[model samples]
Target chain A: MKTLADLKKIREKAQEEMKLRGGNVRIKIVVGMGTSGIAMGAREVMKTFLEEISNRNLTDVLVTQTGEKGLSSMEPVVDLIEDGKPKVTYGNMTSDKVKKVVVEHIVNGRVVSDYVVATGN
Target chain B: MSLKRIDLLICCGSGCVSSGALKIKERFHEVLQEKGLVNEINIIETGCMGPCDYGPVMVIYPEGIFYKKVTPEDVEEIVSDHFIKGRPVARLMLQDEEEKTFSTQKEVPFYQKQVKVALANCGYIDPESIDEYIATGGYEALGTVLTTMSPQDAIEVIKKSGLRGRGGGGFPTYLKWQMVHDNQAEEKYIICNGDEGDPGAFMDRSLLEGDPHRILEGMMISAFAMGATSGFFYIRAEYPLAIKRIKHAIAQAKELGLMGRSIFGSKFSFDAEVRTGAGAFVCGEETALINSIEGQRGNPTPKPPYPAVQGLWGKPTVVNNVETYGNIPTIFLKGADWFASMGTETSKGTKVFALTGDIRNTGLVEVPMGITLREMIFDVGGGMSGGHKFKAVQLGGPSGGCLTTQHLDVPVDYESLKERGAMMGSGGVIVMNDEKCMVNVAKFFMDFCVDESCGKCSPCRIGLKQMLDILTRIDSGYGKEGDIEELQRLGEAISKLSLCGLGQSAPNPVLSTIRFFREEYESHIRDKSCATKVCLDLMHFHIDKNRCIGCSLCAKKCPVSCISGSRDEKYTINQLPCVKCGNCMDVCPVKAVTKVPGMHPEVAAKRLAETKLSHNYDE
Candidate 1:
């Protein structure tokens, strides 16, 4: 941080971290925690994701929280982002459904199309 | 990893947050994880997107689908239909006034009409995270200036952009920078005028809170260009959020080596600090702000040595407004010509207005400079609220004048507004309706001026009080015949003899209202009545005999029992005993109760005709 070179080095490190965390990353799970979403069982859904990610020793998977997705009534909405691909959204999720998703989608790389709310690229 | 197929930008501005935007983000995470669709789509929380009334707003990028008023129930439909099915939910998309759905933010009338140079990254990037800012090419402007551009070259670019001070006075920013640069003082200073004291104006506060790094970069450029060793952000204590965000941005920039010693490896070094004002409106004036920063009384010194000549402990300094500084990073990123190309020939670049009051869309709007007030009210603001007619739009915050419907078509540039007795001071455009009394509006501003008056000069100090007394007397139905003439006289004197901008522009609201809505003042004076039926003293409550149902409810409900009649007979309000409290009007089932001015049909007819005339002008 003393000189321009130090800033450049930090920037490189930041870019590396972004590369590890961005679209090219293995998997990203974002849960909507808007006020209404949280009121409608979204917090439990988020907890299930944390439990599933760690319990299965799943690596290359990032779990994050976002503000309202502007679709509040469908609270407890989750967006699954595969590496360098489109996002798959699932709504009205439960802990059992989440465990099945971890086994079928995250591990088996199978698209659970029936439970999906939408697909976005 | 730097590239995401889909980027969902959620507006986390104060307005959206109040309407539950935060919970929506958390829901997205929970649902996405359970579905095993994580990390592919990036959800970035951004600042204000201007459409505040339509809160909990979001714009999904790449496709840029905008959604509004989202609730937990609709999240599933949006997730299934738009995300998994690869189809955007039509019902969730933002609907314009015409009921036509807008897929992207650019398609919305409020945003499409605007050319956002200053607010380019606002509501698009995370304000707290410097990496987000850098990803959007933020500090690259500073690096460009420090690495290659000279102080002279940078100043020339700003001068060429035709960017004036956005605070109040439309003074050229580069000229001020040049003045401080030309000075031979060993140390010069750059003071950012963030003490936005204008009532009903929060554009500066929003920008500071939304994109603090932009202002920092702008300040850093000014410091480098002016050869200043130190800089200060003279933000007011009223803006606690803005202060916190800016403080964080400064710390982040300093840590990343974009601020402090040898910025971008150049030999030049400039460091900035925050100085909070005690929330005095007049302290927004440059010299007063400088005095406050120097730990002295925030009284403005006269303009022989202007702040550019001698400022901040008696050194050469350049003072620029927060919005003015917000433009610098963009001017460098996109050349001066690019900046100059958007606005009018004279007033280049975009202007951010905190559009509030009776306007339907009350939020921050940054339109190109030459856009007419008509477009701002109708196209962007979605017209007047509650079906009320547009009467006058008060611009320039407390220091500005009220522009009537006749002036709506005028191009909103510095010269046009000044010519109409309104100066484009700070960007607080309050769209008033027919319900608002002009004289009362003038009084409100004059009262503000009186309270904020530093009492330095006789014209601004004593003269404003005399004018306020006249306005009060006029508004209360005790006005004399020559009261209007006396107010005009005092207004001119104050403008001529006042020491600072506060004194000089103190008479603006009064003078402008008098000029545009003269009939309101005349009715108040000649008829001892308010044209808009606002003043209580001039009203006479009467029940229309034709429409009366003879319920006698008004009589029973009257606090004073002023109305008298049998249940079957048409009720009449006894004018002598009537308190004019408007209870009878409120209680009347058949809408029989009406208030006429001065109990005369002819006067009422005349006022009705005047109202009709103004309504015609509004359309």
Candidate 2:
């Protein structure tokens, strides 16, 4: 039902959103939802993420899913990104960790040092 | 000033998830927020990056830094050091064992030699998002084809590329396109054969799941070239995630007017649908696949009319495997010369392989054609798993043959592999170490072929079953002197008379193994011995009294209770009760139990000498 103009409008709107969201937010959370991760319960991790973010009223974090990186043994991986900092990846995430991540890391001004897989330090 | 955005990629593939990648993500979020830098960076979960051994891997972009063996506990150091202070943590970075220095992913030997083409978009894009796909230039090929190139022109480009099919047959892809193009059919069909049935292969499934739009775009380009109005994706039902992603891609394409009638405002109109296969291995064969699509029994018919001439409801059809279709858009976009420059003289473009078995890096890899098997098996595959001595490698699935250590330097192209008694059958490179028994490897592949034969023709059905029976008998220490000769004769007969590819190439494993390791077969037949100790029947369990700790672990753990002795004394294996199940060998902490050939040592040595003499004679 969409005409050429409508398609163009949609594209323009998408571009606008990209621009607005592009440089504004500093943190990106990448969730591993590849077949292996999904099979190993990545869905529950993602659900807990959405729930925690919504409940805590945090607006700065952006989440997305990606493919497996060939470690089929340890899945349900998550990568955290902050501006001017090297990316930190964490493995074996659970719902409890999701809540802790949101409240302790996103809300407070401290990195939860215990759960880090790799830190720039 | 606003914080600059950073990209973090986490491996979510099946292997890493089982190792707990999800919990790590949650912990990452907590650490990021606690630092009050949640808005400064971005985390993205991605697909398999192919180094499966040290998995739950994470890679950072702009720098392409690779980290291995990530656990939930290491997140904060990653945040504090890498994310906040702009430094990489050396402990987590993959290290070159010999050099003892942290290496970037590209610098690592395992990834340095790999030329990823079909796997190009695997870890880069968000597979589930249509917009992300569009952003990465997904359907741009279809648009270019529709807007500028004619159907004939598209076919010409494919022919110019000299791209042989990746789906085992090694047929020229453009020739197939040209035949379908020239065929006089009002309604033609394009079929994507995604029924990847090989045991160690998963490249096709990963492609569909990670980049479904690429295949869709390739098919759309092909449809435009061949005047085909409808296409079908004949994928197996085993890949549920791949299926779901493909279905989503199709819907998204249609919504963009890239699939339905008058695509991109051009007269070209094409649509696609999915058809699930019932997990039949034989259905991977083209004719058998055609039969399955037609709602008939999944058995192959003799080729002459060929699918291009007459196929899929008696209409002209072009059936291309998933990998071949995956290459189309890239070929068109990059130009034929660009692609043709990478590989050897005859076989142009890179080939994707599922490198598995006794290799340290057991996952998907794509390398340029004409790369030596040695390079692939050792450099890119990370050598044998657990540092085992490399013995042989099985290229091309069950229908393929074993390549010994002598032929390790053979260039992995269609012609070279074929000349070396193997085919590039969908690029399944399963490395085997010294512990693997050649006789057992042959038997294993033969057994698979027999089980999956579809019983359509006698050569494949009866011949394969009979050959397997002989092999089983030989491996079980029951072969007579002439069993090797009989095996060769039977294998040649089956190769000659088989109705389709399944029957025709079913004897390849047996023939190639015999050709390369005839001595091993002779040892099995003449001396009733298994050199690799893999054949249980040909081996006898013996206790090494010197190494025996007099612990009851071996006797207690033995399923057959073949060992009998007092706790203070060395155990003795009752030859009658020993099933050769190897339970005693596996359970013994002191490594007291061992498998010795039942044949006399002199007889075993003479058989080995005869094998060497025969090999030289054949050469």
Candidate 3:
């Protein structure tokens, strides 16, 4: 804080901490948290994705929650979105399925097509 | 460690805080905790988002959804639906006059044309946190100036930037810095003039409260550029929140060694103290402000030994407005040419305007210089409120003139506004509607000037009083034939002979109204009428018998029992007992009650007939 180097260091650290508030990111994971989705364990699935992302220190990936995807049968749904890549929607997601999706799709840039229910956008 | 998903930036500015923003923030924390999503959703209390008409505003980031007028009760729904469920509340979004809803802050028409140079970090970052400010590139300019640029080099950059004093005078900022720097004083001082006393003006207050560090950074940069060792922030006592935040910013900067001895580990050192003015409008003038800060009476002394040469206990001082300081950091960070490329030929950079009165968006807006009054009022301001037509706009404050509809297209640069009889005095633009009487408007500002006059000089002390008396007479319908001419004469004298800016511009509202709306004053003198019915003495309450349905609503609602007659005969206003409160006019169910301008209906009719249609009733 006393020098230019110190100020730049703090700014860089703060920029990292504030990265979630920024709009541009490499990957976005959307978890359905509507009344029906939450009742079907979507909250646990969202929490799992959050913990996995944080543990990996993936600054480029953002895990968020959404209301409904209009697919009640696939209540615990998760959408993987990356710029220039087609959106991948995984249906009936469980807490155990989050790490595999994060490792393969988020880290390795490969979709877990087994859990994928639909893909578009 | 859970990855945060949403950032709910709730506005905790003074306006929103008064409108229960704190309670809503508390409710958000409670609801997020109840939903066990507290770690995932970050609720940050940010500064003023400008459009205060939609106070208790919250902007959800990542999606950039802006929710306005959010209540404590709405917080739970916002957290559940938007935070967890990710469905933004449509009803809480910003709705325009056409009922068109804008979901994002970027899409709102109020912010469309506004270029935020001074207010860039106002609504975006946390004002209390030095880290948030630094992350947004706050003190980098000060650091850069201290490490690399010499005083002359930094001053040259500012000079090339074309920065002027935003405190209404439009003085060259670099000239003041250079003058202060050139003076061979050991203890030169930099002062931030935060005593914004203009009615409906909170641009300075918002800048101080929202981005205290930016203003501090600005002051420090100027202090560095001018070789100033000490500085003072002369904020008005009316803005307690601004005072607290600025003090907090000073403490944080000192703690981090961004201020005090050898700032940023350089040879230059600077420190600033926050001084609160006693809410005297005259103290906003530079000399008067320096007097108040130096423990003397807030009376202005004569110029020639200006503050740059002899100021703040007889040392070289550079006093700048809050917005002026707010722009200094950006000029260095973004480079001078970038700053100079934005504004007009003479006036450069953006000017922050506190838009109030009949405008739809009653808040702060930072627009580039040379933006037309029509764009400011109609486009950025969202036009006149309550379906009213724009009559005139009172620019500056009590010291500024009124520009009518004819001047709407005039570019609002410093020289352009001065040419149109109004100086950009602190950028307080009070928009008036057609219902507002021009004479009453002038009288309002004149009364303000008369009350705020420091009484040190005769022209300001006695002349403004005489002008106020004339305006009062005109407003109360006792205006005479030669009164307008006398007012113009006194106004010119006051402008030429007054001691400070206060007295010099005291007669502006009166003189400008006389200049533009001369016919309105003539009507008040000759016909004894107020076209807008604002002069209660000239307008009489009349009940149209044809429209009266004998409902007795007006009679019952009349506070003074002025309206008589029962349901059988239909009600009529007893003009003798009527106090002209217009209660009957408001309460009339059948539109029976109306204001008949100038004397009684019969007398007006008789005068009209006797004049043989010689007089023009067309306004």
Q: Listing every candidate in turn, what is its Cα RMSD in Å to the true structure after a full C-alpha superposition?
A: 8.7, 10.9, 4.1
- Stretches of candidate 2 off by over 4 Å are A1-121, B1-4, B26-38, B567-569, B599-619
Tens-digit lDDT track of model 3 for B378-457: 99999889999999999998888999999999998899999989989999999999998898888888888888999999
Interface RMSD score of each model: 9.1, 11.8, 2.0
Worst 10 residues of 3 chain A by lDDT: A15-24
- Superior by TM-score: candidate 1 or candidate 3: 3
Flag clash pairs in model 3: A67-B85
Give the lowest summed-lDDT range of ten residues in model 1 chain B: B598-607
For residues B58-85, write the lDDT of model 2, one tens digit per residue.
7775456788889999999888666644
User: Which prediction has the highest lDDT against the true structure?
Assistant: 3
Model 1 stretches with alpha carbons more than 4 Å out: A1-121, B1-8, B18-43, B71-92, B545-566, B569-584, B598-619
List TM-score per model, in order: 0.80, 0.80, 0.95
DockQ of each: 0.08, 0.03, 0.63
Candidate 1 per-residue C-alpha lDDT over B51-159 given as tens digits, one digit per residue, 9 for 90 to 100: 8878888887555688988876667677655654446778877775588888777787777677777787788777888876766667778888888889999999999
lDDT of 1 by residue, A1-121 (tens): 4444554555554443334223234787887767666678765776687677766756466666666787776677889988677899988777788888889999999978878888985
* CAPRI category for model 1: incorrect
True contacts kept of each: 0.07, 0.00, 0.70
| Top candidate, metric DockQ | 3
